[model samples]
Target: MRKNIQILQDIVSRKGSSKVLTFSIPHVFKALQLLDKEGFVSRATFAKEIHLGEGAVKTLILHLKKAGIAESTKSGTFLTEKGKKLTNQIKNTITKECKVKKSSIIQGKYNHAILLKKYSKMIKTGIEQRDYAILYGSSGCTTMIYKNEKLVFPGNERECFPRDAKTKKYIIENLCPHEEDVIIISSSDDPFVAEISAKNAALWTIAIG
Candidate 1:
């Protein structure tokens, strides 16, 4: 299974330009066929759903198109006759493949083996040396961070405020201290970070991982 994943990763990373010199297990091939049946997935969505990198998905799409098994329109992707037929013929195989892939991803995330290794390295570098870490982003963003490592502040309590201007200002003013420095972790560069910092008279620092 690991070998198959490595092959798929290579194929996607190489934009399917690499020649298939190795045999992919029947299960892996079936899973690819099933994904092809689902027509156009956005780069981000595909990465999030399949646990593959965006660059790899882009390459895989290109390769699938070249193989005449998939057709990608602007909005989404549709399976070609070949792709649909292949998926239908190998329905059982595809189901097994999907289960295997899903299990692998779930295990990876639930165990936090890979993610925690990365976070532990970051923390060791003094990146987490702060009085408090203000994770200002969507709920999904905060959840992902919490999954990677245990939160030190709030004593195991996770709080999320609505993304409203007035409420945001109030939270920053109350939670942040003027004299002490706090670290700000944002998924993106947005004005909300600046607004929160300005309101609290605190400096916003980015957390690099």
Candidate 2:
């Protein structure tokens, strides 16, 4: 079967909590951000965390309240009982997906993991030009394999993989790549594809950064 077609199908068919995890909410990020900051943060801070306008933040908070996941008061916005449980559930799922198996680490010159953002499409083209790429991942993961080549990504479920220049630098330093190495970037939100692709490798070192 064609590897690309199969991978596309798998991405479309992923279901249940996996789907929930795939289509993350903008407001959820804000709520989680507040949760991370001891369960309360000012509106301006919330807006800054999610990179949204002040009016947009207010609207999102209202949405969160309607969804029974958050509330707002003089103290600040906070998660409700349901919200905490949901957040925990999401966290647990991501943790399970991202768990790196020791067996997947391959020994070679070097294997690079990149958080593909500006260069994702370019890398995909490079792999295709080189010929034959086997692919994997659920809705949130993207894994491609070719002769002596492998790529693990956070799929295309989101509009774009979250990133910045600082994040990119961090990836390079951590992955410790060499010249001509294949840099595969994955989202922390969905690492299942990358993890599975690495573990399933027959050759080549697949490193996740």
Compare the candidates by TM-score and give the number of the best one. 2
lDDT of 1 by residue, 1-209 (tens): 23333443343343434554222222224335446655555656655544456565665566667666567778765667866665454332112110001121122111100011112223322233222222322111111122222222222333223233453343234333221122222222333332221111111111233
Worst 10 residues of 1 by lDDT: 96-105
Superpose all Cα atoms of candidate 1 onto the true structure and report the RMSD in Å to 1 decimal: 16.6
- Residues 1-209, candidate 2: write the lDDT tens digits: 12322222232232342322221232343246456557887788866655567766666665567667677889888888866766664333222122321112222122223222222333433333112112433112223321122223323322121333343334445544333343432222334333333322211121111
Instruction: List lDDT for all candidates, in order.
Output: 0.33, 0.39
> What is residue 158's positional error in candidate 1, in angstroms?
48
In angstroms, the error of model 2 at 153 is 8.7
Report the Cα lDDT for residue 57, model 1. 60
Give every collision pair in model 2: 114-184, 114-185, 134-145
* Candidate 2 wrongly placed segments (more than 4 Å): 1-27, 96-209
Give, for candidate 2, the lowest lDDT window spanning 10 residues.
200-209
In order of appearance, the predictions have TM-scores of: 0.33, 0.39
